[model samples]
Target chain A: MLSIEHLTLQLPYYTSWWRRRWAEVLSDVSLELHPGEVHAVVGASGAGKSLLAHALLGLLPEPKHQTGRLTFQNRALTAARQRQLRGRELALIPQSLDALDPLVRSQRQVSWAASRAGHARSDAWQAAGQALTHYQLDERGRQAFPHELSGGMARRVLTAMAHVSHAQLIIADEPSVGLDPQQRNRVLDALAALALEGKSVLLITHDLRHALPIAQQVTLMNQGRCIETACASAFRGDGDTLATGYARALWQALPDNHFGVLTTTQAQNVA
Target chain B: MLSAYRLHHAFADQTAVLDNVSLSLEAGEWVGLNGLSGAGKSTLGQLLAGHLTPQAGVIKVDGAAPPRSGLQPVQWLPQSPELSVNPRWRVKRILEEAWTPSTALREAFGIEPGWLNRYPSALSGGELQRVCVLRALAPGVRYLIADEISSMLDPLTQLALWQALRQVADERRLGVLVISHDAALLERLCPRRLTLSEGRLSPPARHGAQSA
Candidate 1:
């Protein structure tokens, strides 16, 4: 239910204490995310994937200039509107567990999210408990502070917070990083379950394999540029069905595939 | 050879994190260790690298105690490079802390010259990781304890890193202990693969793991 067309962002960088230089952080990126669809944005770290999430959430810092058109439900998405809709219609599943409060309990944190989204305190508490239970967190897990939870348990708590927000669109940035394979799959499966329930999910990550199975469409991003957006099925069987040469090379370089490292001439794109 | 003999470690008020664990790596050997989370793989690696002293065990380099101070022979590269680095320090100072690497080595690791002036917080996670790996490859180091270093990287960046490290390991006879959960990655880079579970090591069951 979101559409971005020719989006570009430039951040001002200080130079010599007297002048400012504009650095292109994102350029000419476009995508269409539909309801009930999980769209994967795959790129190397530092390819501006997180920046894209920030732009959508209206969290980008000041002294930034942009040229873009963001449409949600056929309505123009201004920065003020983005700020207003955040946590109500748009929720972000942050990449770091540090986003959680150290002193507060897990269930309380999740309920706070629900309350911020306009739920009454009593309803929010019940929703938080239900969300945590759906993620398989027992009563003890729900009551534990952030430090007490394991890596996987902490991740499930983040997912639970997003669930209570009841947002129409969710953005998860590198949600599976540092999680073991089993925990990684659990988080990915949870995101897929959200999409199954008709929430639009924007999964931004570097790992394509985990995203491919759950995502119907994939956007390949390079340094400040969107190289190609292709159907997830095109990533299979040597990636010959893929449109961009970079995507094919990336597919071939997978450890389980041909394990081909891009030659130096072509390495500049990913590096 | 770098070896750990009958290592034992346990946190206070808890059961043994490690139990009579022993492992050996000859020069230039590449070994992979995989396990479920909290299964003591990192504990074993830390014990081997001297980051954590096992309550009862001996770690030896060529059958002798390793040097107690200065540049260590075994370097540990953790999963999160950001936490490992000094955020206030510039990349140049960070890389030069242990030793200054040659330009050729920097190129191999894909470290850009412009990054040297930037703080660690300014660089992306992958770039910081490459810098950390290059920094750890000092002339005195002989073995590397790579704990999920490339698990955060994309496949292409992952391949690029292993390729570069392989060249140096071959030249320097560096023994590498790779700790990861990616069975496909373990299978590809290491000929001798072992799984850590319940404070013990065993050969991985080849049929169950998904390919990367």
Candidate 2:
């Protein structure tokens, strides 16, 4: 089980003059994801959702302030207490693919992840291969460098690495952002498969429609606060379903529709 | 106007990223390029903006061929934000590196006064992206090839950013080509849409459906 009680995070001090003026990043945020279920957090950009993800993985950057409780399977998460749970019990799929070491090969990164959980290198290699195949990655892709892989391929490799770590809880942040519709469905299904096997998932994204079909429950966040939390079924009705209403409101605020169109030559002349 | 004829680019391994791509964008048109990852939508956009050279075709911007290096007549916003701007530089400095001065850039970006001194790390993803759009638009470049600028932002922010881009296109009379897989977003912003398939561009039967 995963539980967070009133968890909060603050940005660290920076030498730059601008960093000092920005407001505290996260404030009094609290939510939870239970075993065998998918709890999705949907919010606008700059709402501190990513920071909350960082806080959960104990990966927040230096000099940040954090309070409240983070517990997995009844054990609290502290810098000291989380040492043993780093890989096996808790794992993170970060936003940037470059988060991995640039010098190391992709396969070695997955193997290293497994060894951190006390597995032998040979066993780790086999397990890594198995995970990669399970994720539908080409067997030969294991030898390729990060620079050689496409964005979607890199995401799959990261998932394979996460699987090798044997994490009880997986947190994926906007895992399908740049992928095509088909790839997005594949990635979402894989994560859903993990939840079916009793592993908890904290799926964070901005599109409620993307998560509504996959998530068992959904939490809508706006401006640093979670304004709504309910089962996906509650939003299934027609004509302004909760999810659609929010989406429409957000879409209407976009600047594209606000401006009138320009003729070809006039627009072209500006260049 | 932007046009490419019989465009082809091959990598060292003899793999073709863009194969004989032929497309054109008239002024005042909002074109959305749709493709699965690695479908080479970005490559075609780069070719139009003179960011990349095609091995076998001709590209023209406003009826003129562009040079390989230096700023071409068309402007380009790259895929990765980290690569789009210098991390160590302050936001103001990056914008200044473009053709515009500080006052004009701030006005176009809706940036509050005195916000330019902050570095990219200090800004949120949305803020950084807004800054990037401003920098790209600052040079007053006419043709814009924006490769998935909204992919990293949340819905609310994406909406805002698209609106800003649409306004720029209208005000500047710029030919804007947005590359993305978000069907809803494309439908909302673009009047003419093309799907990149097997390195070829074609109109989809349905406005925003994924063509197989």
Candidate 3:
């Protein structure tokens, strides 16, 4: 379980030339993620989803200001403990597939993760193989280097790492990004499967169409603020037209879709 | 122009990740590659772009083999735009690495002069992505391979980049192979689609058909 209270982060040098002017990335935002549940964070671009991920994982770059109480379960995660928790109690599946080590074999990176967490190399190999297989990766894939694999393969390798580490909490940013339709399904299914197995997932994405269906709870962030949080099933159903409206707005915002534009022009004409 | 003939590649005992896959692109053509996870879409792209060699097949770009491994005859805009840039390099230096002022690269992406000096870390994800794309388009390549280039971008930026890519490809008579999971975007951009499965390549199912 995870909980955040009155979190605020600012970066004075983010806009460099501005000097004394500080740019606020995340405002007084707060939320909770529970075991056996998938909490989705949704927002438009620049809504601070990735910024929040970096802050929560204590990976925010230097000269950044962070003031908040981040408690995992019940204990406060101070600077030192947060660093230790990054790869041990918490795991991250980065937005990019190439986040894997290009020079290292897929197995080696997993082994490194396991070894750093005090597990033996052989155990890590076995766990990595098993995790890869769980994500539908077969024998050949388990031995391939990062560059040798495709986008989807690299994603699967990362998912396998998350699973093998068995981190208590997994923070996945844009888990379905760059995947094809079928691969999107696989990635979503894998995350859902993890939730079903009692792991907590904080899925950060801008696409609600995919996350809304799979996540048990949803939190919408706008301009670094936690605007809304509600039950996923109910939110998709009758009670909350807001989430549905937002989803429709995003679908309309899709650049290549002429249908939305046509409909809007028609409405203007009729009016 | 780009073409692949009976391309086949694999790491080991398993079936080739790209099994005898063949495809071709002519000037001004925009193709989309779609498939399930681990189905070899990127592999096929890399092979066509000369990033990887086929174990038993042939690839030709403008009637010749690509110049180098991991190098595409066309420019490539990878998924993670932020990491693609060198942290210490200023945006001007980063953009300069791929383009020369003698070329019309800046005009293609509408990149104004002032943005060149800022480091990538200072920019937003969308901003960085745009820069990466502009850098890719800076060179006068006749073709492009974009691997989920818009995944990290927001809907607005996504749409803008989509239009820019289409426009540039048209203006330069360039061929483009865009890889993404967004079915709707693929439907809107590409007249032809390539579907991969079990490490094999073939034509996509009809529009609205079930996903692989």
Candidate 4:
């Protein structure tokens, strides 16, 4: 339902009152997410994964230049269109739990999202409770403030907020970071469940292992370029099916499959 | 050696965060501290780093209290580098404020010379973190407490930083305490590991026998 084509982002650095220089941060990146599929964009930090999310959401920093064709549901996505769809047809599960308002109660936060999605106040409140229940949060959890909840609980609450909005496309940026193993699985499973419900998901993460199980298509990124896009099933056994040497090296370097031989593709690239 | 005995700490609400906790690290040793979130591992690290004073218990390095001023022998690298840096100051000032890093040291950390004139805001999180790590590894430091210092970094940056740290520790015989939740990371870097649960410390399951 979502498609990005040859997206490039550049930030301008002012050298003087009249002089300026631009640095390219993202270049010629393209990907697509179909309805009811989880498309994972896997990359190391600074590979511009978050930048792609921001560019799609029209939240790039000022003095930035972007050129790309972004289409959602066969319609070109302009800045105004992105603003229109945000929080309704398009939602983001941000990387930081700090996205939740510290002063607001959890229930009110989810309800606000429901209200934003065009529900009446009374209906929003009911939908908020249902979302909480669906996410396995108890009544006490609904009443608890952000600071009072644990990290895992806060993550579920964020998911509940997105669920209440009923967005068609959900972009989760490293949602599992800082979470324990069980909690990580829970969050990933929730995203997978959302896909099963006919919502398209863009799962942006650094760990390949976390994305492989639920992701149908994995886009490997390096240095702001989409290095390779492969089926999740292609990541088995020595990674010969993987298109790029870097992708194969990445798979082999996993602790479970590490052969103790380092790939010389790039020292800094191989974490 | 760095050691803590019978450490007891509580928050403003009188909730005990750490109770009777004790641990010790010898020079040139790499030790891992593993725990669930909010398990008081950070509290213990802060106590040892002299950031917090425990209500009871004692922390000593080489049978003496930590120096009160002028280049601490024990340094702490917190989880977020953003909090530790001065936004208004240039990167050069931040690095030289604690100790002057040699050119080789700066080169080893991959800190660009151009970054010296830029503010912390101009650098990425990993770059700022490298500066923080270099600052903590200043000339006189004998013991380093890294509390989730690399949790935010990518695997490449994390490995690069850890390799630099390992080299420095080997050369200086520094005692390093690494706090993290990644068991595989601990297994690769630390020869000894300790698990903290609800204010108690025990030897990790996979790693045998705590050193007395």
Candidate 5:
């Protein structure tokens, strides 16, 4: 349902008043997502994983940023189309807990999301509560303000907001952070259920173990570049089936695995 | 040893998050705290680090009240490094806010020199976490409450971080309380693990078929 091809984004800054310099933070990122499937984009901290998400959502702040193609459902995702489709056909579960409004309670924020997603005004609140409950937020959690809620609670509320939306594509950015084992599994299962419901899920995360189970396709990134894209099955057994050395090394680094360290070159580049 | 006796805490209009919880750790040992989210693991960590005072219990470091002023002996590294840092400050200033970490320590944490001039907002989540963890290791700091600090990092980075921390922690003989949801990670990092649930602390019963 969503496709990005050779998408690159560069932000310009002026070293001096006369000279403008561009930093290519995102480079040559390409991926495909289909209905009823979950695609995971995994990478290190500065590997520009989140940048790719922003690029797809047309949230890139650069005016001169365009060197690739983004198509959704057979139509080009132009700037205007991105604005028109955001929050209705496309919803982003932001990485930060700061995305939730501090003044509003969790349920109210989710209700607003449901209302914007074409739910009737009268049904919005009920839909929000159901979504929150589905995501494992109890009644007290739903009533707590963003600051009052724990980090994990706030993140679930964001996922709940996306869940209540009528969006066909959900971009969940690090939805598993700060959650316990059970809560993390619940969120991942919920995302898988979304895909089972025929909605496309683009899960952006750093944990391969958690994402590999539900993700049909895994895109590995390093230093703003796509390292490899492979089926999730390629991650098993010493990662020998994986296409690249970096992917194998990442898989080995899991605590349950060999706990492999990054090679000198890859380590130096990300820092 | 650092110890807490019968700690009790609850938020306004909320049930007790921590009920009669007590834990202790030696100066040269590593312990892991595993719990579901909202099970009061953070509250317990905060109380131990003196960030919060318990309603009914006392925390003592080396048989004395933990000093509320001066350099804290027990430091708590929060889960969200971005929120714990100053957005306007450069990475260098934030890393050096409490004390200056040496070149070797900086390298150990995989902090590049180029990032020092960039603002905290410019660094990715894992990079900022490295800075925060290193900053909390300033001199005179004895215990560390590392609360889900590596959950946002990739596996390789996570392994590297633990290896580096182990080296430093061993050298300094610093006690650490690792709080995380990843049971495998906790098992790898700590020899002793505790699980917090229902406002109480107990040993995790999962074994034989340990899984994430």
Candidate 6:
């Protein structure tokens, strides 16, 4: 389990020797992840969803100030502890395919992750093959380089690598971008299956429709602030049960829904 | 009018990515191309925009071959706007190099004045994409091929972009080809839709004739 309490991050820009301006990138964010549950964080482009992920992973940019209480498995998550847990107990499924090495074969890359997670080399290789197969990659696909794979195939390879590590918590950041509807559903279903196996997942995305089916709980963020956290079931049938006006507006804007007008706050936050 | 006839393309592996595909667009018409991933929809867009030469068949605008040099009437907006522009160049240079957009056009696209001096890396993906859309709608462009241009953007930004594009197309009578996997978006923006499957282009289906 993971819990973040009142997390805040600020970046300082020095205008002069003694004058500095601080920009608040994240503010008073709190979230809790239970074991075997899929929690989704949905927001627009500048809503700081990815920033929250980086902060949790200890991958935030420098020249910043951070204050937060993060606990994992009932233990405080210090920087050292994060480094120790990273890639073993916690793993990130990065948004870009460039996270993969262009020259390395897909299976080999996955095996490397297994090796890092403390598997023997021979065992790592075997697990990598199984992992690739589990993700529906074929024999040729396992041997293909990252560039040789299609967008959907490359995404599956990333998922395979993450699974081979056997991380307890997987942070997937927009894993379905550029994918077709079927491929998108496949990726989401794979994540859901991971949860079914008792792994906690934090699904970060802009599309609420994609997130609604698999997500047990949803947190709505806007302009670096967490607006509301509600049950995924609450986001249906006109959004009357939703707490905030912005959240209701977002729900209404869905194509399958009314496709209604966006509130000024929603429009400004999005554009 | 813009037309492609029996277009065929293959890569070094000698496998056809596109086969005998053909489509056409009349002036002021917004057409949608829908397909699954790796279905050669992007390859067909590239061929129509003259970014790639087909092994066989022909693509013509007004029954003439697409111009190889000078100001092109057909323009392409790729999925990744960051890759389309020169990173070293300032945003002002990138915009002016293509064509000087009217002041109204820049404002309508929500391009900030300060952004003009910054490099591409300093801008966000949505901002960069707005610049790319503006560049594609430059003076001489008559037909626009937007290949998943708004796929990475959020819903509100995506809606803003499509609205701006529709307004521009109507005012300029530009023939626009929007390539996307989003059926909702395709239905909303285009009256005529074409589906591509297994290296083939299906006949156009006239959906709702109602205006967006």
Checking candidate 1 for backbone clashes, the offending pairs are none
lDDT of 3 by residue, A11-51 (tens): 86533555565778899989999999999998766789988
Task: Tell me the tens digit of each residue's lDDT in model 4 across A1-271.
Answer: 9999999999876554578888787899999999999999987667888888888988776878999899999999999999999899999998777799999999999999999999999999999999988888898999999998877789999998889889999999887776666777888999999999999999988778778999999998876899899999999987778877777766765545652336553553443
**Which residue pairs clash within candidate 6?**
none
lDDT of each: 0.88, 0.74, 0.75, 0.85, 0.88, 0.86
Candidates sorted on DockQ, descending: 5, 1, 6, 2, 4, 3
Candidate 5 lDDT by residue in tens digits, A25-80: 78988889999999999999998989888888889786656689999999999889
Collision pairs in model 5 = none
Cα displacement (angstroms), candidate 2, residue A92, comes to: 0.3
Q: Across residues A27-102, which tens digit of lDDT does each residue of candidate 6 receive?
A: 9999999999999998866678888888888887677899989999999998889889888999899887889999
Of candidate 4 chain B, the 10-residue stretch with the lowest lDDT total is: B203-212
Kindly report the docking quality category of candidate 4.
Answer: acceptable
Candidate 6 lDDT tens digits, B44-106 = 898889999889998899789988898788888898888889998889999888788988888
Backbone clash count for every predicted candidate, in the order shown = 0, 4, 0, 2, 0, 0
RMSD of each: 3.4, 6.1, 5.8, 2.7, 3.6, 3.4
DockQ of 1: 0.67
Stretches of candidate 2 off by over 4 Å are A15-22, A236-271, B67-71, B99-115, B205-212
Measured on C-alpha atoms, candidate 4 has an lDDT of 0.85
Local accuracy of candidate 1 as per-residue lDDT tens digits, A1-271 = 9999999999876544678888898999999999999999998877889999999989988979989999987898899999999988999998877889999999999999999999999999999999999999999999999997877889899888888888999999898887788889999999999999999999999989888999999999988799899999998887778777788888888888878844642654443
Quote the lDDT for A153 in model 1.
89
- Top-scoring candidate (DockQ): 5
Each model's fraction of native contacts = 0.71, 0.56, 0.52, 0.12, 0.92, 0.37
Model 5 chain A lowest lDDT segment of ten:
A262-271
TM-score of 4: 0.91
